[model samples]
Target: MLLDLLKLHLCEACSMTELHEAVALGDYDLVAEILRTGRCDPNHKDVDWHDRTPLHWAAAKGRSELVKLLVDHGAQHCLRSDVGWTPAHFAAESGRLGVLRTLHSLHAAMDAADLFGDTPKRLAEIYGHQDCSRFLETAEVESRSYRRTAAMKGIPLDQRDEDWEVKKEELERNPPYSRENHTSSAQKKKGKKRGKQ
Candidate 1:
């Protein structure tokens, strides 16, 4: 396939080769064409560390437009290198707030705790990105408040105001035993004794 051929060509390209050149040096145009044509996988790994994807490079370099393009083409936002750092983590570490925001908007899981128990919010704080940390903190607080209010209203957290279908189904599946059943069985025994008398 064309994708396989391009992967082969890119793998042969040297470490010193610019990714734009590795794709034949057409810059963003060539990268976009390769992605659009499906001639190369944007998720391809370089040979040296095998750790860097095009997305990783784009994010680390703060190439926001290129980052968006790669993400739209299905480049994974959560792909971690051997050291356990995701593209979002790298963006945060590099202080690329624009790239980080773009990734977050794409639904990259900001709450995903890494091996060190550092979510994107924690990473932002550790790396001195106070603005990013503030945004994440506000979002988290709002989400928690919503859940608490829903819980206090006697609603199941899973229901989330969807007419309680999930709660209804749960009750139906595990219906409680009725006192009527026990009382009726007792009455049946007493009537048998009276009939015998």
Candidate 2:
């Protein structure tokens, strides 16, 4: 029974990436060690958690230090989850002002909107994070200014997640549930009911 239990534990452990686990557990030392050894990709998304990366977890957990570590290790802060929620979104939702500040300092896209067209600032407002919302009000303007300056200077910014964009495009093209689809299905149901009557 002990051997079986050990095997089960090992399998469960193997299912979650060490980097994600370390970040989630808030084990700074273990996370640092894992990054140093390059044991896992910092940007690896957790499929079981709506495609959230370690950075997302760190931001949500209000771990500004971990956010820095992940970004330094080449984590893309622009990466979005299944719903297009970036690390900034998570931080804003959880009122992690420090994480937002950390992300802004690193030139993350704080003004990025999710699939629902809600930016981090909007999320902060929605979640009643007045402090975060106030900060983001200025941050969003600065973010846009920085982008424009970079464009004028011909400085390339690594802010876009091309893979996510492509996936988003695919979802838009073949959405499982859209307004038109829902309306058509509703009409079909009504027609069936009328025929029965």
Candidate 3:
């Protein structure tokens, strides 16, 4: 495995090493040790694959405890992957109701959309995750009042306005499950567009 990882020329953030595997495996003790010893970043992303933080894997895998631990340390629920799939999106798609509940309580953006412009609720419905879809629907109805005034409000707690562009670049640099060259070209095009504007 080490040789394979070395041959892949993957960055530390890539899903080529111990940290990413341990998280995916839901090895709680290993995850805790890795984070506690500062051997791995709690927010490390597999830019090459899932374009997700460890928390996303945990949430999607229905490892609620791991998800909580990851969040308690540091994980941004609002951050989008290459395809704009957030951890919330994955949880909903997988029918991980408990994970969805945890994310909702954490104030994960209930209305955030993916690259296809499908929100988690929309995906849940499309995928026949009835219970998860219902949860999102209920939350939407309950939060309607807040949603009305939220557009005019300042940045919510999880997202940083100043960090968006940097985040975008980072996302492009390590797109979810994309070849490096492919993302590099995309990044260049985006960079050029930014320059033009």
Report the C-alpha lDDT of model 3 over 11-127, residue by residue, as the tens digit.
363453565678789999998876665556656567667467677788779888887877877767766666677787888778899988887777666777654467778867766
Model 1's C-alpha root-mean-square deviation from the true structure amounts to 21.7
In order of listing, the candidates' clash counts read 1, 0, 0
Kindly provide the TM-score of model 2 when superposed on the true structure, using C-alpha atoms: 0.82
Which tens-of-lDDT digit does each residue in 131-169 have in candidate 1?
Answer: 877776764455456556766997553212122334435
TM-scores, each model vs. reference:
0.56, 0.82, 0.69
The C-alpha lDDT values of all candidates are 0.59, 0.85, 0.69
Kindly indicate the candidate among 2 and 3 with the higher lDDT: 2
Q: Which ten residues in a row have the lowest lDDT in candidate 2?
A: 180-189
Q: Where does model 3 exceed 4 Å of error?
A: 1-17, 141-156, 160-197
Task: Write the number of the candidate with greater lDDT, choosing between 1 and 3.
Answer: 3
Q: Where is the poorest 10-residue window by lDDT in model 3?
A: 180-189
The parts of candidate 2 lying over 4 Å away from their true place are 1-15, 179-197
Top-scoring candidate (lDDT): 2
TM-score of 1: 0.56
Error of 3 at 179 (Å): 22
User: Which residue pairs collide in model 3, if any?
Assistant: none
